[model samples]
Target: MKHILALLFLTAASVMANTAHAENIGCVSTTWRVVNNDKVCVQSFKDPDIEGVACHVSYAQTGGISGALGFAEDPSRFSISCRQAGPIVAKKPIPKKQEEVFTQRMSFLFKGLNVSRLVDTENNSLVYLIVSEKVIEGSPFNSISTVPLMPWGTQAPQFQLK
Candidate 1:
């Protein structure tokens, strides 16, 4: 039964596309399993639409028979931190409202991890929020990070959202 479920999730993975592509930074094992080890992992991704900003997220990854086959539902246990890696620059149009910038699957179908960016015009900052979403239920597990658009060595770029 678990194998059947795992197969279904793997099939769905082929069809469902994740908007963000993250590079694994590292992982630390938490529990020992026969096939694999349950671990906490950190992954980093750059904002595709925006330049000079990068985010690193960490979350728990399940292990064991089910997890090894990519069938287990990962917990909505994650945190995010985004920073200005270089001089701030808006590569595309800045939206006035909150915009989803990244997404990763957390479960078979109904659950996912999402990241969004909001331009804080009043504060002259960019706020990034990460949330866990499920189709049938709401999750309170979420995190946020902010980056202030300031001068990097002599270049100060102020932004206006459209």
Candidate 2:
């Protein structure tokens, strides 16, 4: 029995360590409790790898072992928001379909929030998309923000496949 307990302890520790590392390298994970004390604000941050384009994402966390094992019956509920907190300059205008800049899991059951950056070529603007998803259904909670590329002399070149 002792051996079994020790092995389980080791396994749990390893899983937790990997989760922490995954959350740190390319993203930031944080937890904030809801005012009602029934849910937590779990957020993940992913900065655009491209220079001059900065993005941040925050989302809510709902269901977890706490609710499953600790007698907390209510699943966690969340809200998400994203913003371009800096000057928007593109080394090159990113493609519309290839615009998913960041993604993070919002729950253990395959729910997630994704942020994508789209180039509105006709309007000469940049559009940011924030969407929430789950395994069975997607949340209607979606938001969009746009930044119009100004009259700067540097024009974005059209993308072409080599």
Candidate 3:
């Protein structure tokens, strides 16, 4: 029974691991703080479950003794932009409601950056929303970007909604 439980746990983890991951593209200095420098970090990520869409996010990162040590909680200020990178195709069904596509840790604990995706069937677009989350408090700040179904390399995507 223990081995079976472990296998189930591993399977669940592997399935959930399809979440999108970001690559650190660059950072720009924002302010010179004590013991370190505050800056904005730019990250790029591709949709893990969806094809032909890429997103770029820029957010502020606190820099100081605490931040340098990975203890500071990043502010809830970020911008997102997603564009069509290639021919969009989905063999499986996609959700019409918002679904989480990515999550990035901004602190040692209690804070993270998340991106969600929603297929706008009416508008024939894919919407991506980025937000910051805290364990105790909720954030109202978020950014959204959309990629409309359009021509790519002489072929247009036939969006299928389920």
lDDT of every model, 2 decimals:
0.83, 0.49, 0.84
What TM-scores do the predictions have? 0.85, 0.51, 0.85
lDDT of 2 by residue, 1-162 (tens): 799767855754453433212133232324344332333443445334333344434444333445444433322233334344444444454556636666555554345566666667789666777777665687777777665655324544233211
To one decimal, what is the Cα RMSD in angstroms of model 3 from the true structure?
Answer: 4.5
lDDT of 3 by residue, 1-162 (tens): 799767855754553486777899999989998787899999999988778899999999999998899899888889999999999876567878888888777777557788999988789889998888776786999999999988888887846666
Comparing 1 with 2 on lDDT, the higher-scoring candidate is: 1
The TM-score, computed over Cα atoms with residue i paired to residue i, of candidate 2 is 0.51
> Which pairs of residues collide in candidate 3?
none
Predicted candidate 1 versus true structure: per-residue lDDT over 3-68, tens digit per residue:
977886775465334345789899999999889899999999988766788999998899988888
Candidate 2 regions with alpha-carbon error over 4 angstroms: 1-49, 63-93, 151-162
By lDDT, the best candidate is 3
